[model samples]
Target: MKTPLTLLGLVLLTAASCSHESLTRPAPPPGDSAERGRELARRLIIVDGHIDVPYRLQEKLSPEGEPTEDISQRTAGGDFDYPRAVEGGLDVPFMSIYIPAELQKTAGASKALADSLIDMVEKLARTSPDKFALARSVDEARRNTSEGKVSFAMGIENGSALEDSVANVAHFQKRGVRYITLTHSADNLLGDSSYAEGAHRWNGLSPLGKQVVAEMNRVGIMVDVSHLSDATIRQVLETSQQPVIASHSSCRHFTPGFERNLSDELIRAIAAKGGVVMISFGSGFLLQAAQDHEKRLREEAMAFIQQQGLTRESPEVRTFIENWLREHPFPRARVEDVADHIDHVVKLVGIDHVGLGSDFDGVGPTLPVGLEDVSRYPNLFRVLLERGYGEAELEKLASGNVFRVWRQVEATARP
Candidate 1:
């Protein structure tokens, strides 16, 4: 075996020998293939269909002027910060206007969240029009691309923002909100959530939920069925007058334990309706091991809060718990496993109906290791290529297909 010094001497000798005229070697095989992918990803309109930046901004700009509680700066630390987004090659991200599901049944739920989240996106676009602009159409998304600006679009995670009224769906569309998830954690006026604690049951969409779907289509808002019960998914697929979108969901085929994923039946229904299912990178929605591990961790976290007599409603208690979870975190899925979901969606619903939708801040610190944050998106591209996705298909998955769907839906909108 060569000693360290001897190895260094040999390497130096090789360098000296290379000065001879006959030194010839085919241009060292091109660098990381991800460069090509990354360049394309950067130049093209890359989008994560959902993120929770408003939660951070709202937490920061609260009227009380930053919490007086266990107030750490990171309470305002979100995964998709502006500088990090540029570094990650993300050109467009549907900033999620997520209203807690429980609030919808209350008095001012719809108007409050709708006004609040929409304002957040508007403010971000206003403060940095050089960096981002609110895109109401896919054409605008591409136009923003030419201007070197990120497209900031909106997706309502829970239809509770519609406030159980047929008119509010269009209200959001006027605010530049594009899609609406018909249900969330608990059943809203729209339908039941896949994760809501209950036995296997089915009521599909209520009369109002069906009206919401029709109204969403008429207003050009893509009907998003992410958190909906399977029955509700079927209803939206059948009722939607335009292409539907599962804004941030994965294939149940890839991650068996997660109820949040779309089944083969649901996948086919969505694609059959000319819709797209942007695959989610959340560990809970991707791999079985990652999901089970995360579920156990959440249970343990809940127990810890209980033992400590902490309450979510208490600012101090919530802050401590949030920081605690951020520090401890959850078991991570691998980048390759995250790509495995992309592969599953492609196989299940063709390359024309898949895109990336990493639930960055919304997943509660349960992202994969290589995908620890939005900055690691290049790793996902690299892993996808390694898994055999060609450039053409990868382009469709990154954002092209989503753009196409948006265009078709926008062009066909009655609004």
Candidate 2:
């Protein structure tokens, strides 16, 4: 059988070539508005709803099982680190415990991986108490910020980690996990995935998924709608008593047909229910040109691999991908495009329903130009400021909106 061209495989193939040129730090923003934007970024409590730091570290484990890169200090690769997050004024970054969809095929494998990743996060906080702290609630995260530490709030990217057990929802909640994306690249027992091909398994959410949603609400976990099919999202909205969040999705209005992003109707629905849609910073998530470019590159690269009779994992295929990427350099989106997405959401449903959720370290090299990594958040703020956003509105976009939703989720839970 031909090797399945997995999303993770594609990301690895293009990561090196897709990355922007190295920068010690982003240059200081120019003009009065830029300066004010930078100041506001430092002053506000910025909460990025989704970041893939834990999984990124897990991917770089040494043979001895230790992490190769030290996030406590600046490292060569990846998007997040202590220094960069501090510079960006990022207070709370929800570390994604990303469980691969294929792991669901095995009985306990998914839950096992989730437990291991959770252990890894706990270890990070335990070892670096001064630099990092675990935040299980909005109040705790705010306290961590006051203490000058970056708060690591956890969110499971795929619900396969629940392993067909409704009981696992409460189990993860007790482990500092604040949100759970019900499905990933493939359909699970809970629901259908936006990216899953063929007919949907559950059509919307299975009976087990509805129970999971209810359990999550009762246990103080935010139900994440990102990566789920439209049917699943609607069902979740209906079933969830507390506000839900799309932890890292952009507006689908920009990248049409990209079901991975939220539609205008869906955005309004999420907003009507008092939830927030955290706009993602990936280039493909921001622009139609960038999305088209990515799709074309994948198709061409796959055709070349098959024509050359090379395995996807072969060195020859890797070299071909690098060359192809270099030759057809991806159409990069700018920081302005990111602001446009935020603006689109605000226009459709007001600012209360939108926040930032940069899929850092997860989107490979497909990040936007001015918003390349954790240290570049002020660049986005500068653009928003230029477009006439006041400090109060900017603060709402920064963390206030998501925190409100989170607090409501917490309050809705039964003791």
User: Which pairs clash (backbone N, Cα, C closer than 3 Å) in model 2?
Assistant: none
Q: How many residue pairs clash in each candidate?
A: 0, 0
TM values, all candidates: 0.83, 0.92
180-256, model 2: which lDDT tens digit per residue?
99988889999998888789998999999999999999999999999999999999999999889999999888778
Predict model 2's lDDT versus the native.
0.85
Q: Estimate candidate 2's RMSD in Å.
A: 5.2
lDDT of 1 by residue, 225-264 (tens): 8888888888777787778888888888756655678898
Off by over 4 Å in 1: 1-31, 62-76, 199-202, 295-330
Best by lDDT: 2
